[model samples]
Each structure stands twice: as C-alpha cells, then as structure tokens.
Target: MVYQETVAAIKQLVRDGVVPGVNYAFIDQKDVTRGLFGAEQLIPGYEPLKPNQLYDVASLTKVVGTTNVILQLITEKRLALTDKVSDFLPEWQDQRVTIRHLLTHTSGITGYIPHRDKLSAAQLHDALLTMHVGENFEVKMVYSDVNFIFLGWIAEAILGQPIQTLIQKRVLDPLRMTHSTFQPEDPTRCVPTEVSPTRGLIRGVVHDPKAFVLKNHCGSAGLFSTLDDLIRFEQAMLFNTGQPIATHWLTELTRDQTPLGKQWRSLAWALLPTQLPVAHNCIWHSGYTGTFLVLDQTTQQGMVFLSNRVHPHAPNEAFLARRNAIINTYLAEKTVSSKTE
Candidate 1:
C-alpha cells in the first residue's frame, strides 16, 4: 500500500498500453520494495514481466555508468572538473569546453551530424570531436548526449581503458550490481525496447542509435540493467556506501554544479524542482527506453522505474506527459508523507 498513488498510475499506464509493463523499485537506507507489472513482450509471444529482466536503460548510462567512472577518476585526483576537453583528447578542438561544462550539460557543443546514425563508429567519434560550441555555451542548459559521449572518451583517455571496462570495474563491481551490464549475453533475459527497422526487435543490445553504432565504445548510452541492480546502485549513492566514489565527491555529484545556476543540474543528474524556494534534494535521470531513477539525498530514498515504452513502437507526447504525471505523483506523495512524519 506504500506508494499507492504511484502504483495506480503505473497500472493505468499498462492498461492504456502506454508501456507494455514496468519493473520498479523504491529503496531507502534499510528497505526496498520491488514490483513487476504486465508483459515484457507482446508480439512474438505473450510473456509476463519477471524479475531480473535486463533493460536497455538508454541515457541512464550517462549517470549510472559514465558519470560514476568520471567521479571515481576525479576522486582519485586523476581528473578535474576544470580540465579542458582538449587536455585529454587532442582531437577535441574546443578549448573553451571543460569537464564541468560537459557534466552539467553547459558545454553548448550542439553540432548536428548529418545521418549521424549511419556514421561508422570511427566517423562518429571524428564528428563529435570536430563539433563546435553553440551560441548559448555555458549560458543555457541543453541536455545533449554529446556531452556524455565526450566524457566517456575523456575517461577512457585518462584511464587508458575502454569506457565499458572502466564502468564495470569502477561502478558495477564496486556497487555489487551483478545484473547491470553493457551487452547482456542472453537475449531472453533482456527486455526488448524498439522495433528498429534495421535491427529488428531491439533486445539484448542497446536502443540508442549512436550507442548502437559505437557499441560499448561510446558511453552516452548502451547500458543494460535491472530494477534490483538499480536499487543497489541507488542505495549506494543515497546512503554513501563509499566504494566506487568517496563521500566528498558524492556530495559534489548531488549538488547543483551549473555554472550560472540558471538551470539546475548536478554533476550528471538533474535536480528536480519543488514548490519550496529551495530546490528539492532529489537528483534524477531518465533513459530514452522509458527508464528513470530518482534519489532523494535528504530523505535517503530512491526510486527506479524501468519500462519499455518504445517497445514495438516509439512513444508519443502523450506517453511522455503521462510518464511525468506518474513521477510527479510519486514525488507529491513523498512530500505529503514527509510532512506528516
């Protein structure tokens, strides 16, 4: 009965066919509650959603994988927020862009690569390095996958290992997130995302086009995780388990790091706005594959919602609106509960 409103909203989404199903978890310092609702696959065969199913987890990779690796490096003093992109990647021509800009999404590196999905991995890498800054650089918050793509490269450059490997060793292993992985070995264990024209049903592989092109080499996306693993990951962050990253750096990761403070963004997570004058103590991020994670530092609570909203087809504006409503309902309920306690 806890999170009753949120549970109703999720069930409504399933009934409306907004998403095939959702696997979600609510976790705090001591306890976790998880639920699986609906089917994982609707076309090939009717399959009930089950625990331990891996989700593509699209942009959540930025925070769950790439951002954590960057944070660990920074904590070890191997990297700095002030370090320029040009410092690590010699091909990056934008001297004005810093690690801080990329983490906070203020880099303004907004060049559009024509037929970007068609580009080869090496070609995509080349195009990203040549991207120039936008006019709003550092003045506006434009969330771009390009920022984390570059961060992944920078982390690799500093560590001399692939981004996936870095993420595995630095984050997944440390957090004991056994169910989280880049490319799942068994397709059956993975939840399908979109029915891509070129790739058929996007199952075990990543759903993001650029990430698919770059494979595990690119870090903007391409992570496969489960609700249980994500709960562990969130608990580690919310409770400061202090294995993958230090407590000081975790504090920095959750705090707003926007240069001008015009738009609130933590190191890699977005700070959710509340009605209160002060911002909410929650840092959250969403994946394009209908997955999202929210962690409330002050309350030591976290929520992970994973759904394949894009499965069989892409989502519409209505799906997005309803998804936001579901999240907001959870936040509102939490807020009310906090006041009563």
Candidate 2:
C-alpha cells in the first residue's frame, strides 16, 4: 500500500526528532484506517500503537465536540449565527457579538488564555473577563479561542447541560465514536500524550494545559480520540441528500460562511471554494495537534491523519509538506475526478 510508504516517510521524519509522535487515519465512503509513527506518547517500552489508542486531538475538539453541539442547537432553533452572543449569555450581549463573529473569530475577543492556558473546562468562561481584544489590524479576522469559549457557555445555557454531556448526546452518541471523549475516561486504552517531567505519562489525560485546567471539557480544545473515531465523525456530517440534516441544518452548515481560510464553515465542516469548475465539493478540516482530515465529497473519498506532533516537542513544519504530498497521492490513487467542474 502506498499509504505504508507515506507512513514510513512520516515515521522516518519523526524518528529523526522531526515530530513527537504521529497518528493518522483515512476514509472513503467505505473503509477506515489509522496509522502511527513515533513515540511522543509512550516512551522507553517500544509499545506498538493501535487503532483504538486515544491521543489529545487538540483543536479537533472544536469540531468533533463543541462545534457540533452548536450545529444541533442551531438546527433545533435554539441558536442562530446572527444571534448575538449575549442572547444566550447575557454578558456577551454587552459586547454585542454575534454567532457569525464568534465562529469566524472576528468577535473582538482577545483570546481568553495562552495557547497553553486556554482550557477553561468548568469555569464560567467569562470571556471578555480576561481577554484584551488585541490591536485594530489584528481584529480583521482574529482566530481567537475565546469565541468558542463563549459558544460553549452559550450551548450550555440553551441546552441546560454540561458541554461534555451535550456533545455525547448530540454528536458522539449518534456517531458511536467509542474511542472518543472530552474528559479522560479510560486510562489504559488511551495513548498517553506527553512524558514531560511536569505532566508525567499523560495517558488517557489531555495534554493541552488549557483543556486540563478548564475541566478537560472546554469548547476550544480538550478531547482525546483515535483517528478512526475522528473519521467516522467527519463522515457523519455527510449524511445528506434526503437526510434529516442535509435538507435542513446540515445544508446551512455545509455552506461556506467566509473567513475560514477561504472556505465557508458551518460548525465543524469547511467547504472549499473553487475558482474554476468541478463536480462534487469537498468538506475538510485539520487539527493543530499534528492532525488533518479532508473529505472529497466529489469522489466520495477522504483522508485523515493525527499525531501528538505538538507533544514533548513542537510539530515539524515539514509534516504539512508531507501531508500535502500524501493527500495528493491518495487522491491520485483513487483516480479522483472532480464532479464540481
């Protein structure tokens, strides 16, 4: 399998101290796959990685957990993009921020905490409480985590449940993502994230300090999952063309909303824009924890890759270069033909 070569190359790069650990998965309309390389997770013992092994998905939680809840709330008419943040959280109305502003990170929120400190699990998340709103030019489209911070709170206000509980009920339960969760549930089955002196083994525990502090169930980050579980969640968003969400809310979500790196985003899905012509469109997303997933709806094919790449050490910048090559390789292997044109 060429994917083996792709894994080999990715693994080779990491063993050379390129990345901390790499875990990846890919999907088509049918089968799913998870591959691993490096040991940013376990150390010294040479334990082989497994498909069910959980890793800190980092910002992937934005889509897989918190964002999906937002979609459900919107579908139920419990929320709206145009709805001001203060509608659900009265304090947010003070800033007069809207869901659109929050989703696109242009809400004038000065990200709530440091990348290492963004996790606010059980706290009220009193967004503007600590954020600084940054400089004027930087506000054009700030990708602030605080936006989701408020979204999480807003979801709780509307749903009347903890954000984690709501995620399981709406998204995780439906998809049967057995290997995924916002809070660290099972220690043994999970791949410990970092072996750092301060954090220890980190197995089944979230490695992101922000998530760790925020009760491990914040909206912006803090969820542990396998690449396999991740892909299935992505595929679930494709239940359309006569499906419940497709004709209604999913369509709204699948449509591009702008400011999301040239793609229109609804909840967790980002639809790519085309300059020319094509047949079917593509819905995709990537994770900052050395993970990426892109689904080419046109070909009914998709790819997923996950890594603790940011653990123990920073992720290798070249990992993305390799990711691009592997994606093109997979698409070519499938002989993907754009239906969008």
Candidate 3:
C-alpha cells in the first residue's frame, strides 16, 4: 500500500476514462512497487492490462535510448558534448550547434516540414538537415524532437551502424533492459496507442509520425518497453551499477546543464518545476504516448508511468490536466516522505 495516494489517483484516471489503463512502477534503492490498472485495449477488443506488456514509450526513447547511447559513447571517448553537429553531418549548416546544445534542447534549431510524415526516410533526413537555427539559438530552451532525431543519426554515424543496433549494444543490453526495443517482435504483447487515420489502430508500431517514417533510423521516438524493463533502467541509473554510462556522466545528467534564466534542463531530461530543494536534483521526461519517467537522484527514488491516453482517439486538455495532477500528487507525496526520513 505504499504510495497509496498516487495509486488511487491513477485508478481514478482510468475510471474517468482519461486513459484506457496504466502500468506503473515506483522504485527506490531498496525495492520496487508496481501496479497495473484497467485495460490495455478497449476499442478493437477489450483486453485486460497485464504485467510485462510493452508500451510505446514515445519520446522516452530519447532519454532511454538515444541519450543513453550518446553518453556511453562520450564515456568511451568516441564523442564529446562540444563536438559540432556540422562535424558529423556536413549537411547540417549550423556550425554553432553542439552535442551539448542538442542534449539540453538549447540548439535553437527551427523549421517545419509540411506533411513531414509523408516524406520518405531519405527525404525526412534531408529536410531535417535543412532546419536552421534562428536568432534564439542558444538563448532559449526549446523542447524539440528534431534535436534527438539528429542525435540518433549522429550515434549511427559514429558507430557505423543503425541506431537500433547501436542502442541495443550500448544501452539496452548493457543495462539489462531486455524488453526494451525499437521494434516489438509480437504485436499482441504490446499496448495499443492511437488509432491514426492513416494507420488505423497503432499497436506495437510507433505512434510518432517522424519515428514511423524513419523506422529503425529514428532517435526522437519509437521505443516499446515494459514497466519491468524500465524499472531496471531506473535502478541502473540510481545505483550506477551494471550500466555502460560512467558515474560522472550519470551524475551530470541529474544536474542542471542550462543557464539560470532558461527553463532548467538536465542532459536530455527536464528538471521538476517546484521551489523544493529536492526538485532541483529531480529529472524527468515524458513520451507523447502517455508515458513518463521521473528520477530523484538525491533521494534515490524514481517512477515509471505508462498508459495509452492516445488510444482510440487523441487526448484533450482535460486528459493532460488530470495526468499532471497525478504526477504532481506523486511528487508531493515523495517530498513529504523524504522529509520524514
């Protein structure tokens, strides 16, 4: 019954039809508590949500896959945060953008390709490379998938392999995240995402438009992972054991890497917004597919929230409001618990 309030809040979300269901886990250095609430699929067929079912972790892929691999490469001295984007991809005209800028989302890279999902993989790559920075370059913090998209390609270029293979060898396998993958081998075992107009029921396949187009080449999104596997990732990060990433790099990821005025960003992770002292050391990231990860390095506590809010239809503002409430409640509870300890 630990985290009972947070658990009740999530159950209410399902009861209100905000999400079909949610599979979540709360982790600390000592133990992990997991919960499964509601159904995994309610539209095409009613399926009871079960443990170990893969959820399309959307942009969590950026942190769990691309960012992790990038850090490992840096640890191995194969890459540097200061390395210019143009150095790896000559088509990238901006010499000022560096690996650090992309990780912290200060790249200021801006552009939009119309019907970007309609483009072929090669076409998308070329268009993304054409995206240029504006006057805001490095002056503001803008969360953009384009940054991670470029990071994914850079990892591939440095390793001379596809991003899928690179992530498997560098991040997932090393961390023992066996169920995490860009490609899900069995569709039924995966939680269904949105029912896209073009793709119908998006089960197993990635729901991110850019990732769907780029397939295995994608870095921005397109990862399917189970709650158990993500708990493994969180434990690795918290304990700094059995992970390929160096201890220093892992520590750096939890600290603010951005300037004072800007929204605080850690390396590929967003710091929690609150006046609490612990908030400064807590990092988090969310996937578009109703998934998110939060880790408090100081307390050695973390959480994994996975749901299919986009399933059957897209989510509205109300869904988001409730989702934030659930997360906020959890954070508030954790804050109180930390004080007592």
Give the top-scoring candidate (lDDT). 3
Q: 1-341, model 2: which lDDT tens digit per residue?
A: 23565566667767766565677666655666667666644464556565557777777777677776787677787788788776677654345567877776666665434444443433435434455445532236545566776787788888688777777777777778876777666786766555667666666776666556766336777777777777776676554422224346544554656444343554455565432234334656666666666766544556777766655444457667766676656555444233332
Give the C-alpha lDDT of model 2.
0.63
Q: What is the C-alpha lDDT of each candidate?
A: 0.85, 0.63, 0.86
Rank candidates by TM-score, best first: 1, 3, 2
Better of 1 and 2 by lDDT: 1
lDDT by residue (179-271, candidate 1, tens digit) is: 889978999999988787788887898888888888868888988998888888888888877446778766665567989975879898998
Clashes of each: 0, 19, 0
For model 3, state the Cα shift of residue 251 in Å. 2.0
Residue 184 in model 1: lDDT: 89
* Candidate 1 residue pairs that clash: none
